[model samples]
Target: MAATLFPDNPDFIKRPPFETDELRRCLTNYLDTPFEFDPSGARPLVGNYRWGVYAFFDYDDEPIYVGQTNEQLRTRIRRHLTNQRTDAVAMSVLDPFEVHDIEVWPLPQFQDVDPKKDRTAAMAARLHLDALERRITAQAITNSQFKAILNEKDPPPGELTVEVPPSTRGCIVSDRVREIRGHPDFRIARRALIMSRLAQVISERQVKGGLRRVMLTQAKRLEWLAARRFEATGGARTVPQEGDQDGEE
Candidate 1:
Protein backbone atom coordinates (compact mmCIF):
# COMPACT_ATOMS: atom_id res chain seq x y z
CA MET A 1 0.00 0.00 0.00
CA ALA A 2 1.13 3.56 -0.74
CA ALA A 3 1.21 6.06 2.13
CA THR A 4 -1.75 8.11 0.96
CA LEU A 5 -3.95 5.31 -0.32
CA PHE A 6 -6.40 4.51 2.48
CA PRO A 7 -8.13 6.35 5.32
CA ASP A 8 -6.83 5.55 8.82
CA ASN A 9 -8.53 4.04 11.81
CA PRO A 10 -6.66 3.89 15.13
CA ASP A 11 -8.53 0.95 16.65
CA PHE A 12 -8.40 -1.33 13.62
CA ILE A 13 -5.21 -3.18 14.53
CA LYS A 14 -3.34 -4.33 17.62
CA ARG A 15 0.35 -3.66 18.20
CA PRO A 16 3.48 -5.87 18.28
CA PRO A 17 3.75 -6.39 14.54
CA PHE A 18 4.90 -9.77 13.14
CA GLU A 19 7.78 -10.78 10.87
CA THR A 20 6.83 -10.89 7.19
CA ASP A 21 9.87 -10.76 5.00
CA GLU A 22 7.99 -12.99 2.58
CA LEU A 23 4.93 -10.81 2.60
CA ARG A 24 7.00 -7.69 2.18
CA ARG A 25 8.91 -9.19 -0.70
CA CYS A 26 5.76 -10.54 -2.36
CA LEU A 27 3.81 -7.33 -2.04
CA THR A 28 6.62 -5.21 -3.37
CA ASN A 29 7.09 -7.57 -6.28
CA TYR A 30 3.39 -7.67 -6.98
CA LEU A 31 3.05 -3.89 -6.99
CA ASP A 32 5.94 -3.60 -9.40
CA THR A 33 4.45 -6.15 -11.83
CA PRO A 34 2.45 -4.99 -14.87
CA PHE A 35 -0.87 -6.74 -15.20
CA GLU A 36 -4.06 -6.45 -17.26
CA PHE A 37 -7.10 -7.32 -15.17
CA ASP A 38 -10.29 -8.82 -16.58
CA PRO A 39 -10.58 -7.13 -19.96
CA SER A 40 -13.27 -9.05 -21.82
CA GLY A 41 -16.83 -7.97 -21.23
CA ALA A 42 -17.65 -11.66 -21.00
CA ARG A 43 -17.29 -13.82 -17.88
CA PRO A 44 -13.89 -14.43 -16.24
CA LEU A 45 -12.20 -17.81 -16.33
CA VAL A 46 -9.37 -19.45 -14.37
CA GLY A 47 -8.13 -23.05 -14.51
CA ASN A 48 -4.91 -22.94 -12.51
CA TYR A 49 -5.01 -25.02 -9.35
CA ARG A 50 -3.01 -22.60 -7.31
CA TRP A 51 -3.62 -21.45 -3.78
CA GLY A 52 -2.62 -17.82 -3.98
CA VAL A 53 -3.33 -14.20 -3.15
CA TYR A 54 -4.77 -11.63 -5.58
CA ALA A 55 -5.79 -7.99 -5.74
CA PHE A 56 -8.00 -5.60 -7.72
CA PHE A 57 -6.37 -2.34 -8.76
CA ASP A 58 -8.23 0.78 -9.78
CA TYR A 59 -7.59 2.87 -12.90
CA ASP A 60 -4.44 4.42 -11.49
CA ASP A 61 -3.30 0.89 -10.66
CA GLU A 62 -3.70 1.15 -6.92
CA PRO A 63 -4.92 -1.88 -5.06
CA ILE A 64 -8.50 -1.48 -3.86
CA TYR A 65 -9.09 -5.02 -2.64
CA VAL A 66 -7.17 -8.25 -1.88
CA GLY A 67 -8.09 -11.88 -1.26
CA GLN A 68 -6.64 -15.38 -0.94
CA THR A 69 -8.05 -18.81 -1.66
CA ASN A 70 -6.92 -22.43 -1.79
CA GLU A 71 -9.39 -23.10 -4.59
CA GLN A 72 -8.94 -22.92 -8.31
CA LEU A 73 -7.50 -19.52 -9.04
CA ARG A 74 -10.00 -19.27 -11.91
CA THR A 75 -13.19 -20.18 -10.06
CA ARG A 76 -12.77 -17.83 -7.11
CA ILE A 77 -11.22 -15.02 -9.11
CA ARG A 78 -13.99 -15.39 -11.66
CA ARG A 79 -16.46 -14.84 -8.90
CA HIS A 80 -14.80 -11.53 -8.07
CA LEU A 81 -14.37 -10.24 -11.62
CA THR A 82 -16.47 -12.15 -14.16
CA ASN A 83 -19.22 -13.67 -12.04
CA GLN A 84 -21.45 -10.92 -10.72
CA ARG A 85 -23.95 -13.58 -9.73
CA THR A 86 -22.24 -13.55 -6.35
CA ASP A 87 -22.85 -10.84 -3.73
CA ALA A 88 -19.31 -9.51 -3.30
CA VAL A 89 -19.17 -7.20 -6.29
CA ALA A 90 -22.92 -6.51 -6.15
CA MET A 91 -22.53 -5.45 -2.53
CA SER A 92 -20.15 -2.77 -3.88
CA VAL A 93 -17.08 -3.98 -2.02
CA LEU A 94 -15.61 -3.78 -5.51
CA ASP A 95 -17.05 -1.81 -8.39
CA PRO A 96 -16.73 -4.06 -11.43
CA PHE A 97 -17.12 -1.50 -14.20
CA GLU A 98 -14.34 0.74 -12.92
CA VAL A 99 -11.77 -1.89 -12.05
CA HIS A 100 -8.83 -1.26 -14.35
CA ASP A 101 -6.72 -4.40 -14.04
CA ILE A 102 -6.08 -7.64 -12.17
CA GLU A 103 -3.16 -9.94 -11.25
CA VAL A 104 -2.57 -13.20 -9.42
CA TRP A 105 0.46 -15.11 -8.15
CA PRO A 106 0.29 -18.87 -8.14
CA LEU A 107 0.72 -19.21 -4.41
CA PRO A 108 0.31 -22.98 -4.52
CA GLN A 109 3.07 -23.39 -7.03
CA PHE A 110 5.17 -20.76 -5.26
CA GLN A 111 4.76 -22.53 -1.93
CA ASP A 112 5.01 -26.02 -3.43
CA VAL A 113 1.51 -27.03 -2.37
CA ASP A 114 -0.92 -29.35 -4.12
CA PRO A 115 -4.63 -29.05 -4.91
CA LYS A 116 -6.80 -27.57 -2.14
CA LYS A 117 -8.72 -30.77 -1.53
CA ASP A 118 -5.83 -32.37 0.33
CA ARG A 119 -6.87 -32.06 3.95
CA THR A 120 -3.48 -31.62 5.55
CA ALA A 121 -1.78 -29.56 2.85
CA ALA A 122 -4.89 -27.49 2.27
CA MET A 123 -5.20 -26.74 5.99
CA ALA A 124 -1.61 -25.59 6.17
CA ALA A 125 -1.98 -23.53 3.00
CA ARG A 126 -5.17 -21.88 4.22
CA LEU A 127 -3.60 -20.97 7.56
CA HIS A 128 -0.53 -19.65 5.84
CA LEU A 129 -2.61 -17.67 3.35
CA ASP A 130 -4.77 -16.18 6.10
CA ALA A 131 -1.66 -14.99 7.86
CA LEU A 132 -0.21 -13.82 4.58
CA GLU A 133 -3.28 -11.73 3.81
CA ARG A 134 -3.18 -10.31 7.31
CA ARG A 135 0.47 -9.42 6.97
CA ILE A 136 -0.06 -7.59 3.66
CA THR A 137 -3.16 -5.80 4.95
CA ALA A 138 -1.34 -4.78 8.12
CA GLN A 139 1.71 -3.66 6.21
CA ALA A 140 -0.50 -1.64 3.87
CA ILE A 141 -2.17 0.07 6.82
CA THR A 142 1.14 0.83 8.45
CA ASN A 143 2.33 2.62 5.35
CA SER A 144 -0.95 4.36 4.52
CA GLN A 145 -1.59 7.96 5.50
CA PHE A 146 -5.33 7.44 5.93
CA LYS A 147 -4.66 4.04 7.64
CA ALA A 148 -7.52 2.28 5.88
CA ILE A 149 -7.76 0.35 2.63
CA LEU A 150 -10.72 0.25 0.24
CA ASN A 151 -9.92 -3.42 -0.28
CA GLU A 152 -10.26 -5.89 2.53
CA LYS A 153 -10.66 -6.28 6.30
CA ASP A 154 -7.68 -7.12 8.48
CA PRO A 155 -7.20 -10.72 9.49
CA PRO A 156 -8.22 -11.77 13.00
CA PRO A 157 -5.78 -12.16 15.94
CA GLY A 158 -2.65 -14.09 15.17
CA GLU A 159 1.13 -13.77 15.11
CA LEU A 160 1.67 -10.28 13.72
CA THR A 161 4.50 -9.33 11.42
CA VAL A 162 6.98 -6.52 11.99
CA GLU A 163 5.71 -3.31 10.47
CA VAL A 164 7.07 -3.08 6.96
CA PRO A 165 8.17 0.38 6.01
CA PRO A 166 6.51 2.13 3.09
CA SER A 167 7.95 0.81 -0.13
CA THR A 168 9.76 2.86 -2.74
CA ARG A 169 8.25 0.55 -5.31
CA GLY A 170 7.61 1.88 -8.82
CA CYS A 171 3.91 1.82 -9.65
CA ILE A 172 1.58 3.55 -12.08
CA VAL A 173 0.94 5.99 -9.24
CA SER A 174 4.65 6.61 -8.79
CA ASP A 175 5.79 10.18 -9.21
CA ARG A 176 2.12 11.09 -9.40
CA VAL A 177 2.36 14.75 -10.31
CA ARG A 178 5.16 14.36 -12.82
CA GLU A 179 3.41 11.40 -14.38
CA ILE A 180 0.16 13.30 -14.63
CA ARG A 181 1.87 16.42 -15.90
CA GLY A 182 3.69 14.34 -18.47
CA HIS A 183 0.75 12.19 -19.53
CA PRO A 184 -2.44 14.14 -19.16
CA ASP A 185 -4.49 11.27 -20.55
CA PHE A 186 -4.36 9.50 -17.20
CA ARG A 187 -6.37 12.30 -15.67
CA ILE A 188 -9.26 11.64 -18.04
CA ALA A 189 -9.25 7.93 -17.17
CA ARG A 190 -9.38 8.81 -13.49
CA ARG A 191 -12.38 11.06 -14.03
CA ALA A 192 -14.12 8.34 -16.01
CA LEU A 193 -13.62 5.85 -13.20
CA ILE A 194 -15.23 8.18 -10.70
CA MET A 195 -18.15 8.86 -13.01
CA SER A 196 -18.63 5.15 -13.58
CA ARG A 197 -18.76 4.46 -9.86
CA LEU A 198 -21.36 7.17 -9.30
CA ALA A 199 -23.42 5.84 -12.16
CA GLN A 200 -23.49 2.45 -10.51
CA VAL A 201 -24.56 3.94 -7.21
CA ILE A 202 -27.32 5.99 -8.82
CA SER A 203 -28.67 2.99 -10.66
CA GLU A 204 -28.58 0.92 -7.50
CA ARG A 205 -30.51 3.59 -5.62
CA GLN A 206 -33.35 3.19 -8.15
CA VAL A 207 -33.19 6.88 -8.98
CA LYS A 208 -35.27 7.97 -11.93
CA GLY A 209 -33.69 9.39 -15.06
CA GLY A 210 -34.83 11.30 -18.14
CA LEU A 211 -33.46 13.58 -20.86
CA ARG A 212 -32.99 16.86 -18.97
CA ARG A 213 -33.14 15.39 -15.47
CA VAL A 214 -30.96 12.41 -16.25
CA MET A 215 -29.98 11.51 -12.71
CA LEU A 216 -29.17 15.12 -11.87
CA THR A 217 -28.91 14.39 -8.15
CA GLN A 218 -26.39 11.69 -8.89
CA ALA A 219 -24.69 13.82 -11.50
CA LYS A 220 -24.12 16.57 -8.96
CA ARG A 221 -22.94 14.11 -6.34
CA LEU A 222 -20.55 12.59 -8.88
CA GLU A 223 -19.10 16.00 -9.54
CA TRP A 224 -18.51 16.47 -5.82
CA LEU A 225 -16.90 13.09 -5.51
CA ALA A 226 -14.62 13.67 -8.48
CA ALA A 227 -13.63 17.09 -7.23
CA ARG A 228 -12.70 15.75 -3.83
CA ARG A 229 -10.64 12.83 -5.12
CA PHE A 230 -8.75 14.97 -7.60
CA GLU A 231 -8.27 17.76 -5.09
CA ALA A 232 -6.64 15.37 -2.63
CA THR A 233 -3.76 14.69 -5.02
CA GLY A 234 -3.62 18.25 -6.36
CA GLY A 235 -5.20 17.21 -9.59
CA ALA A 236 -7.92 19.83 -9.31
CA ARG A 237 -7.37 23.57 -9.43
CA THR A 238 -9.46 26.44 -8.19
CA VAL A 239 -12.20 26.98 -10.74
CA PRO A 240 -15.27 29.19 -10.72
CA GLN A 241 -18.28 27.51 -9.22
CA GLU A 242 -20.88 26.59 -11.77
CA GLY A 243 -23.93 28.81 -11.46
CA ASP A 244 -27.43 28.09 -12.62
CA GLN A 245 -28.12 29.46 -16.09
CA ASP A 246 -31.40 31.08 -16.96
CA GLY A 247 -33.20 30.80 -20.26
CA GLU A 248 -32.79 33.81 -22.56
CA GLU A 249 -35.55 35.38 -24.59
Candidate 2:
Protein backbone atom coordinates (compact mmCIF):
# COMPACT_ATOMS: atom_id res chain seq x y z
CA MET A 1 0.00 0.00 0.00
CA ALA A 2 1.35 3.41 -1.02
CA ALA A 3 0.92 6.33 1.41
CA THR A 4 -0.81 9.41 0.04
CA LEU A 5 1.33 12.56 0.14
CA PHE A 6 -0.05 16.03 0.65
CA PRO A 7 2.28 18.49 -1.18
CA ASP A 8 0.84 21.67 0.29
CA ASN A 9 0.83 20.39 3.89
CA PRO A 10 4.06 21.30 5.64
CA ASP A 11 3.64 18.50 8.21
CA PHE A 12 4.67 15.87 5.69
CA ILE A 13 8.48 15.57 5.71
CA LYS A 14 11.34 13.21 6.37
CA ARG A 15 11.89 12.48 10.07
CA PRO A 16 15.33 11.11 10.71
CA PRO A 17 16.24 9.26 13.91
CA PHE A 18 19.39 10.32 15.77
CA GLU A 19 21.40 7.52 17.33
CA THR A 20 21.90 7.42 21.11
CA ASP A 21 25.69 7.77 20.87
CA GLU A 22 25.40 10.68 18.44
CA LEU A 23 23.22 12.58 20.90
CA ARG A 24 25.53 11.66 23.77
CA ARG A 25 28.47 13.06 21.86
CA CYS A 26 26.62 16.32 21.16
CA LEU A 27 25.62 16.66 24.81
CA THR A 28 29.14 15.98 26.02
CA ASN A 29 30.69 18.57 23.73
CA TYR A 30 28.12 21.23 24.65
CA LEU A 31 28.44 20.60 28.38
CA ASP A 32 32.21 20.91 28.31
CA THR A 33 32.08 24.70 28.37
CA PRO A 34 32.96 26.00 31.87
CA PHE A 35 31.05 28.61 33.90
CA GLU A 36 32.11 32.12 32.91
CA PHE A 37 31.62 35.31 34.91
CA ASP A 38 30.87 38.55 33.09
CA PRO A 39 30.76 41.23 35.79
CA SER A 40 31.03 43.90 33.09
CA GLY A 41 27.59 42.71 31.86
CA ALA A 42 28.94 41.98 28.39
CA ARG A 43 28.21 38.69 26.61
CA PRO A 44 29.41 37.61 23.19
CA LEU A 45 26.32 35.72 22.09
CA VAL A 46 27.21 36.72 18.50
CA GLY A 47 28.27 33.42 16.97
CA ASN A 48 26.95 30.12 15.68
CA TYR A 49 26.95 28.45 19.11
CA ARG A 50 24.00 30.46 20.35
CA TRP A 51 21.47 27.69 20.89
CA GLY A 52 21.34 25.42 23.93
CA VAL A 53 21.04 25.47 27.73
CA TYR A 54 21.93 28.32 30.08
CA ALA A 55 22.11 28.68 33.85
CA PHE A 56 22.16 31.74 36.11
CA PHE A 57 24.06 31.82 39.39
CA ASP A 58 23.92 34.26 42.29
CA TYR A 59 26.80 35.92 44.18
CA ASP A 60 27.07 32.92 46.48
CA ASP A 61 27.38 30.67 43.43
CA GLU A 62 23.88 29.26 43.80
CA PRO A 63 21.78 27.97 40.93
CA ILE A 64 19.02 30.44 40.04
CA TYR A 65 17.61 29.11 36.75
CA VAL A 66 17.91 26.33 34.20
CA GLY A 67 16.60 27.03 30.70
CA GLN A 68 16.93 26.06 27.05
CA THR A 69 16.49 28.25 23.99
CA ASN A 70 16.01 27.58 20.29
CA GLU A 71 16.82 31.15 19.41
CA GLN A 72 20.12 32.90 19.90
CA LEU A 73 21.18 32.41 23.55
CA ARG A 74 22.90 35.78 23.58
CA THR A 75 19.82 37.78 22.69
CA ARG A 76 17.57 35.79 25.02
CA ILE A 77 19.96 36.00 27.98
CA ARG A 78 20.70 39.66 27.28
CA ARG A 79 16.98 40.40 27.52
CA HIS A 80 16.88 38.74 30.92
CA LEU A 81 20.12 40.17 32.32
CA THR A 82 20.38 43.56 30.65
CA ASN A 83 16.77 44.68 30.63
CA GLN A 84 15.33 45.73 33.99
CA ARG A 85 11.71 45.48 32.81
CA THR A 86 12.16 41.93 31.57
CA ASP A 87 9.29 39.79 32.77
CA ALA A 88 11.61 36.80 32.59
CA VAL A 89 13.18 38.00 35.83
CA ALA A 90 10.10 38.47 37.96
CA MET A 91 10.31 40.52 41.16
CA SER A 92 8.05 37.97 42.87
CA VAL A 93 10.61 35.37 41.95
CA LEU A 94 14.21 35.91 40.72
CA ASP A 95 15.71 39.34 40.08
CA PRO A 96 17.78 39.71 36.93
CA PHE A 97 20.44 41.84 38.67
CA GLU A 98 21.03 38.98 41.07
CA VAL A 99 22.37 37.07 38.10
CA HIS A 100 26.05 37.64 38.86
CA ASP A 101 27.25 34.75 36.75
CA ILE A 102 26.03 32.82 33.71
CA GLU A 103 26.99 29.44 32.32
CA VAL A 104 26.08 28.23 28.86
CA TRP A 105 26.15 25.02 26.84
CA PRO A 106 25.99 26.49 23.33
CA LEU A 107 26.35 23.62 20.89
CA PRO A 108 28.19 25.34 18.02
CA GLN A 109 29.32 22.01 16.68
CA PHE A 110 25.68 21.29 15.94
CA GLN A 111 25.76 24.07 13.34
CA ASP A 112 28.40 22.36 11.27
CA VAL A 113 26.82 18.96 11.72
CA ASP A 114 23.40 20.24 10.75
CA PRO A 115 24.57 22.84 8.17
CA LYS A 116 22.37 25.47 6.51
CA LYS A 117 20.88 22.94 4.08
CA ASP A 118 19.61 20.54 6.76
CA ARG A 119 16.85 21.08 9.36
CA THR A 120 16.60 17.55 10.69
CA ALA A 121 19.84 17.68 12.71
CA ALA A 122 18.97 21.04 14.28
CA MET A 123 15.55 19.75 15.38
CA ALA A 124 17.16 16.66 16.85
CA ALA A 125 19.74 18.80 18.66
CA ARG A 126 17.04 20.97 20.24
CA LEU A 127 15.25 17.89 21.60
CA HIS A 128 18.50 16.49 22.96
CA LEU A 129 19.31 19.82 24.62
CA ASP A 130 15.95 19.77 26.36
CA ALA A 131 16.64 16.29 27.61
CA LEU A 132 20.03 17.36 28.91
CA GLU A 133 18.54 20.36 30.71
CA ARG A 134 15.94 18.15 32.42
CA ARG A 135 18.65 15.77 33.52
CA ILE A 136 20.76 18.54 35.07
CA THR A 137 17.75 20.15 36.76
CA ALA A 138 16.66 16.84 38.29
CA GLN A 139 20.12 16.14 39.70
CA ALA A 140 20.44 19.63 41.17
CA ILE A 141 17.05 19.39 42.90
CA THR A 142 18.16 16.35 44.86
CA ASN A 143 20.55 18.63 46.71
CA SER A 144 18.55 20.87 49.06
CA GLN A 145 20.71 23.88 48.25
CA PHE A 146 19.88 23.78 44.55
CA LYS A 147 16.24 22.67 44.79
CA ALA A 148 15.13 26.28 44.27
CA ILE A 149 16.38 26.95 40.75
CA LEU A 150 13.74 29.20 39.12
CA ASN A 151 12.64 27.44 35.98
CA GLU A 152 9.11 28.63 35.12
CA LYS A 153 8.21 25.41 33.37
CA ASP A 154 9.64 21.99 32.72
CA PRO A 155 11.32 21.39 29.36
CA PRO A 156 9.78 19.24 26.64
CA PRO A 157 10.36 15.47 26.37
CA GLY A 158 10.21 15.51 30.15
CA GLU A 159 12.20 12.70 31.76
CA LEU A 160 13.48 12.23 35.32
CA THR A 161 11.64 15.34 36.52
CA VAL A 162 10.83 16.61 40.03
CA GLU A 163 8.04 18.94 41.01
CA VAL A 164 9.06 22.38 42.22
CA PRO A 165 7.51 22.42 45.70
CA PRO A 166 4.75 24.91 46.57
CA SER A 167 6.86 26.43 49.33
CA THR A 168 9.73 26.80 46.87
CA ARG A 169 7.57 28.25 44.11
CA GLY A 170 8.65 31.89 44.23
CA CYS A 171 11.93 31.11 45.92
CA ILE A 172 13.57 28.89 48.54
CA VAL A 173 14.69 29.84 52.07
CA SER A 174 18.14 30.76 50.81
CA ASP A 175 16.59 33.36 48.50
CA ARG A 176 14.98 35.15 51.44
CA VAL A 177 17.82 34.74 53.94
CA ARG A 178 20.87 34.98 51.75
CA GLU A 179 19.98 37.07 48.68
CA ILE A 180 19.51 40.45 50.42
CA ARG A 181 21.69 39.72 53.44
CA GLY A 182 24.76 39.03 51.33
CA HIS A 183 24.24 41.87 48.86
CA PRO A 184 26.88 44.66 48.81
CA ASP A 185 24.38 47.44 49.57
CA PHE A 186 23.05 45.93 52.80
CA ARG A 187 23.03 48.77 55.31
CA ILE A 188 21.94 47.20 58.59
CA ALA A 189 21.76 50.40 60.68
CA ARG A 190 18.51 51.79 59.27
CA ARG A 191 16.96 48.72 57.65
CA ALA A 192 14.97 47.55 60.70
CA LEU A 193 13.19 50.90 60.94
CA ILE A 194 12.33 50.68 57.25
CA MET A 195 11.06 47.14 57.62
CA SER A 196 8.77 48.19 60.48
CA ARG A 197 7.33 51.10 58.52
CA LEU A 198 6.70 48.87 55.54
CA ALA A 199 4.96 46.32 57.76
CA GLN A 200 2.78 49.08 59.14
CA VAL A 201 1.85 50.35 55.68
CA ILE A 202 0.82 46.87 54.61
CA SER A 203 -1.25 46.50 57.77
CA GLU A 204 -3.08 49.75 57.05
CA ARG A 205 -3.73 49.20 53.35
CA GLN A 206 -4.52 45.49 53.79
CA VAL A 207 -4.98 45.33 50.03
CA LYS A 208 -3.26 43.11 47.50
CA GLY A 209 -1.86 45.80 45.27
CA GLY A 210 1.46 46.71 43.64
CA LEU A 211 2.43 49.25 46.32
CA ARG A 212 1.60 46.72 49.01
CA ARG A 213 3.62 44.05 47.27
CA VAL A 214 6.71 46.25 47.23
CA MET A 215 6.24 47.16 50.86
CA LEU A 216 5.83 43.53 51.86
CA THR A 217 8.92 42.44 49.97
CA GLN A 218 11.14 45.13 51.50
CA ALA A 219 9.73 44.57 54.96
CA LYS A 220 10.47 40.88 54.91
CA ARG A 221 13.96 41.54 53.58
CA LEU A 222 14.68 44.14 56.27
CA GLU A 223 13.17 42.11 59.10
CA TRP A 224 15.30 39.11 58.23
CA LEU A 225 18.37 41.32 57.96
CA ALA A 226 17.69 43.08 61.28
CA ALA A 227 17.39 39.74 63.02
CA ARG A 228 20.77 38.66 61.69
CA ARG A 229 22.38 41.98 62.63
CA PHE A 230 20.93 41.86 66.13
CA GLU A 231 22.42 38.42 66.60
CA ALA A 232 25.82 39.66 65.43
CA THR A 233 25.81 42.95 67.44
CA GLY A 234 24.49 41.31 70.67
CA GLY A 235 21.89 43.98 71.38
CA ALA A 236 18.23 43.91 70.43
CA ARG A 237 16.71 47.32 69.82
CA THR A 238 13.02 48.07 69.45
CA VAL A 239 11.82 47.93 65.87
CA PRO A 240 9.67 50.99 65.15
CA GLN A 241 6.10 50.32 64.09
CA GLU A 242 3.65 52.52 62.12
CA GLY A 243 3.71 55.71 64.19
CA ASP A 244 6.88 54.88 66.09
CA GLN A 245 9.05 56.73 63.58
CA ASP A 246 11.06 58.48 66.28
CA GLY A 247 13.00 56.01 68.40
CA GLU A 248 13.97 57.75 71.64
CA GLU A 249 15.62 57.08 75.02
The candidate that wins on TM-score is: 2
Q: Show where candidate 2 strays beyond 4 Å.
A: 1-48, 84-86, 90-92, 113-117, 143-146, 159-230, 233-249
Please give the CA lDDT of all the candidate structures.
Answer: 0.48, 0.49
Q: Which 10-residue window of candidate 1 scores lowest in summed lDDT?
A: 164-173
Candidate 2 C-alpha lDDT tens digits along 101-217: 556655544535443556788766666666767765665455425244555455576453433211101111233344444543454443444445545555675545544544544
Candidate 2 structure, TM-score to reference: 0.48
Model 2: lDDT equals: 0.49
Q: What is the TM-score of each predicted model, taking all chains together?
A: 0.47, 0.48
State the lDDT at 184 in candidate 1. Answer: 30
